[model samples]
Structure formats: C-alpha cells, structure tokens
Target: MKQVLGSCLCNRVTYACENNFSQFHLCHCTQCQKATGSAYAANLFTDVDNIKWLTGEALIMRFNVAGRSISNAFCGECGSAVPYKSLSGKALVVPAGSLDCEPNIQPQSQIFYTERAPWFDSVTVCKKFDSMPK
Candidate 1:
C-alpha cells in the first residue's frame, strides 16, 4: 500500500493515507469556491478507514458552510484546510494542496462547471458538470 503524508500549516494536525487514490476531482461549485476562497478545490477521494490522524486532534476544527450540509475541517491554529468526510460518512476527501508529499494524481474531472467564476482560468480537458450529477 502506498502512503501519503499531510499536515496543517502549524504542523499541529497531521495525517496519513494508504493505497494512493482511485479518483481525483476539482470542484468549482459556489460553496466550494467560497469555502476555499480560490478558483477551485482539488480533492482526492479515498476510503475513510484508510486514513490515520497522526497528531493534533485537539487543534482541528470544523465548519459547516451555510446551505451546504457537508462540513469542512481545518486547523484551528493556522487555519489550514484539512480533510473532509461526507455527511453520509462513507468516504474522505483530502485536499491535494494540503498534502505533505505530492499526491501523484491529477483531477480526473471538474464539477459544478457552470458555477465556475467568470475570471477563473480554463484548464484541463476532463469532464465538466453544471452541478453534482444526478
């Protein structure tokens, strides 16, 4: 199994993942854009059971963005985004930018394409979605 390491900006909260990843996606929904304050968010989906928190459980904080049922986790000290789990409690989504080592994965698709900001750069040829696909 491959292992990947990640930590918050303060180095307080750390985590590790095994088995590389099967899917990578970039989300551009308004909620994601507002939460990340960026053009889009790069996320890697992996089994929740495969992740292990290595440190600073006490410094981790969670926020539920308005109107979005999903909650986002981050470091309380340095405010660095951490991995987030789905409300269904089945999987984990780790931000590629937060990884301590390169994730060695590229987004396979872009989601909420229609909601993407007008000024956001257009890159990648992956499939695009107007919203979470039904």
Candidate 2:
C-alpha cells in the first residue's frame, strides 16, 4: 500500500504512514468527545512504528490524562490532533481528520455507543449542507 501523509491545520507538524491500518473506530466516550470537541473521535489504529514524523517533531505536545490511560498529542502551535502511541505502546492512534486522504478501510464500529452525545442522532435527520446553511 502507498504511504499517506498527514498534517496539522497550521501545517507545522507532518507525518507519513502506510495505508495499512488494523482498525478504525468512532468512539463516543465522553473523554474522546471532550478531547475532540465533537460528538465522537474517529481514530485509526496501526502498528506502533507505523508513523514517521516528517517535520516539526519537536513542536509536538502531549497530554496524558493522569490516572487514566487516555492521552492526546497535537501540534503545539495549532493544537491539531496527531498520531500517538497508545498507553501500552502496543499501537499508534491516528486521528482520522489529520489524514490527507481517506483510509483504505471504513470505520469498523462505533465504540462506547451508550456514551454517545444526546444530540448525536439529530444530525441524521437534520438538514444537510455543504457549508453553513443559508
């Protein structure tokens, strides 16, 4: 599979990873929601060594949720989420939005479904728009 590139909104942090992902999940857990500031977090899991930092490696910052396993790494300049190793260091977690191209696989499942935001279901029935509704 061809390698894919990912970067932050400010283009300060960049990385490359192969399209070989083991799992993709949309997590509705509150922590994930809070971390992403969204209804859920779409994450792709791959081997720990799957990612290669291409630029601004030193500018990356990480926050480990103390007493919990959850952690997030992002660009210090733009605060855009990036790939990081899991607490166990068993796998690399990539924020789906950071990717330059779509993944080869679709989301395998919606994890923590019970924890989904209350308004999560409203979007399906809500008016669709390419941009803000006029």
Candidate 3:
C-alpha cells in the first residue's frame, strides 16, 4: 500500500498515512475558510484507521464546531493543520498542505462554492510568482 508522511510547521508533530484516500475535496465553506485561514481547505478523505502518528501525538489539538459537522485539528506548538477523524466517525480528514509528498489522487470536487469568498474568484487570474516577491 502507498504511504505518505506529514509534519507540522515546527516539525513538532509527524505522522504517516496509508494513501488509501477515497476522495479529495476543496471545501469553500465558511467554516473551512476560517479553520484554514485561507480561501479554501484541501482535504483528503480516508478510513480513520489508515493514519499512524510518528511523533508529538500529545501536541495535537482538535476542535469541533458547536452544533456543526465542521471540525479541525492542528499541532499545538506550530499551529499547523493535522489529520483528524471526521465528525461522522467514518473517515479521517487529512489536510493536504500538511503532507510532505503529494498523494496519488487529485481534488475530486470543490464544495460549498456558493459560500466562497468574493476575492477568491480572481486569484486564478492573478500573476503567478515562482517564489517570494523580489
């Protein structure tokens, strides 16, 4: 089976997951935007049992939105996103940005498109810089 490694920003937390992802979703919902502090969240969905924490498991923190299905997890030390089981208890949601390598699957769909931010629409048309502005 394929495997992928992931780490938090400070490298305080590390993990590995069997790349058995069934879906890749770019969520534009309001909750997802707030949790990621970005235009959208790239998440990979897989069975909850597929992940294994390599280190800093104690530093992982999870938050579930009250009365909502939205939830997220992060590394306590670096505030970097991490994988967590979905509220439904069926699948694990892995933050694509946290992965050290790309997964086999590409994004399957963009959800909550109607809730997307106005500025998000023009991002694709903006200049693409290879690196930091100089």
Candidate 4:
C-alpha cells in the first residue's frame, strides 16, 4: 500500500494516509472557500482508518458547518489547515495541496457549483453539480 505524508507550515502537525484515494473533488461552497481562504478547496477522501496522525493532536481544532462537524485540524503555531475528518466519523478528507508527495489524483467533479463565487469561472470541463449531486 502506498503512503503519503503531510504537515502544516510549522511542521508541528503531521499526518499520513493511504496513497490511494477513493474520491477527489473541488468544492466551491462559501464555507469551503472561507475555510481554505481560496477560490476553491481540493479534497481527497479516504477511509478514516487509512489516516494516521503523527503529531500535534493537542493543537487540532474543529468547527461544525451546516450541522456537519468539520474538523479543521491544524498547526496552532502556523495556523495552517492540515487534515480534516468528517462529522460522520467515517472518513478523512485531506487537502491535496498539503501532501508532501504529489498525489496522482485530480478533481473528478465540482460541488456546490451554484454557490460558487461570481468571479470564479464555470467548470465546464469535468462533471459539475449544482449541489451535492444526490
């Protein structure tokens, strides 16, 4: 099994996960944009068991958004968003950009397309969903 390691800017918080990701997505929701301080968020979803925390468990913090518990585990010193676990308590969604190794994955879909900022370009390429695409 392949493994990938990642850490915050200060290196106080570290994490590792299975290199094989089950799903990848770019979220354009306002919550994601604010949380990441970016136009969009690139997330790689994998089983919770595949993720391992190497350091700084005490510094991790969490917040609930729209009833979903979004854990914003980060380095308290650097304030960098590290890894986040779902409130469902089933999976870990790591920011692809935070990985130390380049993950062989690309955004398969864009979610919350309707909520995307007006300045953002419409994702005409890959599948786009207005909401969660349920």
| C-alpha lDDT of all candidate models, in order | 0.82, 0.94, 0.94, 0.80
Model 4 segments beyond 4 Å from truth? Answer: 66-71, 122-134
Please give the RMSD of candidate 1 to the true structure: 8.2
Worst 10 residues of 3 by lDDT: 12-21
TM-scores, each model vs. reference:
0.83, 0.96, 0.97, 0.82
Candidate 3 lDDT (Cα, 0 to 1): 0.94
Q: Candidate 4: minimum summed lDDT over ten consecutive residues — where?
A: 66-75
The full ranking of all candidates by TM-score, starting with the best, is 3, 2, 1, 4
Q: 17-132, model 3: which lDDT tens digit per residue? A: 99778999999999999998999999999998989999999999999999889999999998989999999999999999999998879999999999998899899899988999
* List of clashing residue pairs for candidate 1: none
Better of 3 and 4 by TM-score: 3
Model 4 local distance difference test score: 0.80
Candidate 1: tens digits of C-alpha lDDT, residues 42-108: 8888887778889997888888876676567889999888987877788888888889877767779
On lDDT, the stronger of 1 and 2 is 2
Query: What is the Cα-based TM-score of model 2?
Result: 0.96
Query: Residue pairs in steric clash, candidate 3?
Result: none
- Which runs of model 3 end up more than 4 angstroms from their true locations? none
